[model samples]
Target: MQVKQVETETEQKQAYHVRNTVFVEEQKVPAELEIDELEKEAIHFVGYEDEIPVAASRLRFVDPYGKLERICVLKEYRGRSFGSQIIKAMEAAIREHGFQKSKLNAQTHAEDFYQSLGYQTVSGEFMDAGIPHVTMVKEL
Candidate 1:
């Protein structure tokens, strides 16, 4: 598997396709909500397996904090650690921008997954897009 910080339109599209498959199609997140206005301002990352995009994520610099969002791994590739790779790549990108802390609104069921990566819950459970979520943060 290979993961890189997306720097071109084609790369960005590939990332979007992965997110579309995982978030919009499979998870029932509205297409409009999945692809938000923040796309243009965020740094994107994509993970590939044998030249096929399998995971995608983005980081938005919000002042003193770097916000991680739209992280998703294709259903067929879910168990392969591509999600972790994408997150690591985004964290590196955030660090490159001089940010020392990163945050994300994680699906509640996946809270443990984020915690395993050293993120801690920073807010109580909340509803986002009709799904339960929690705010998580990690110091980089």
Candidate 2:
């Protein structure tokens, strides 16, 4: 298993495919919410378990500080820490981009997971793409 920076067009497609499989196909998130127009600018990542993409995410540096968003893992890879691996890789990428802080809107159920990674909640829970979410931030 490896976490790689998605560099080519094919890898980019695989990343989006994995995200769609988990968030759009399985979770019922609107296709619009799963695929965004900002993909072109965001730094993307894909986790491959022996060439099989099992997880993915994107770093959208929309603000002065980067924003981690669109993180998803295939169902079979859940509970195996692939999600955590993705986040760590994304954070390193954020640091490489010279940002000292990053933020994300974590789904309510996964708040503890992000908290375990040293992210602290910054806002009350709210709804996003039909899922409850709260803003979280991490200082690099």
Listed in order, each prediction's TM-score against the native is 0.96, 0.96
Q: Write the per-residue lDDT of candidate 1 for residues 1-32, one digit (tens) a residue.
A: 79988989999999999999988889999999
Residue 34 in model 2: lDDT: 79
State the TM-score for model 1: 0.96
What is candidate 1's CA lDDT for residue 5?
A: 84
Off by over 4 Å in 2: none
lDDT of 1: 0.91
Could you list the CA RMSD of all candidates, in the order they appear? Answer: 0.9, 0.9
Tell me which residue pairs clash in candidate 1. none
> What's the lDDT for residue 21 in model 2?
95
Model 1 misplacement above 4 A:
none
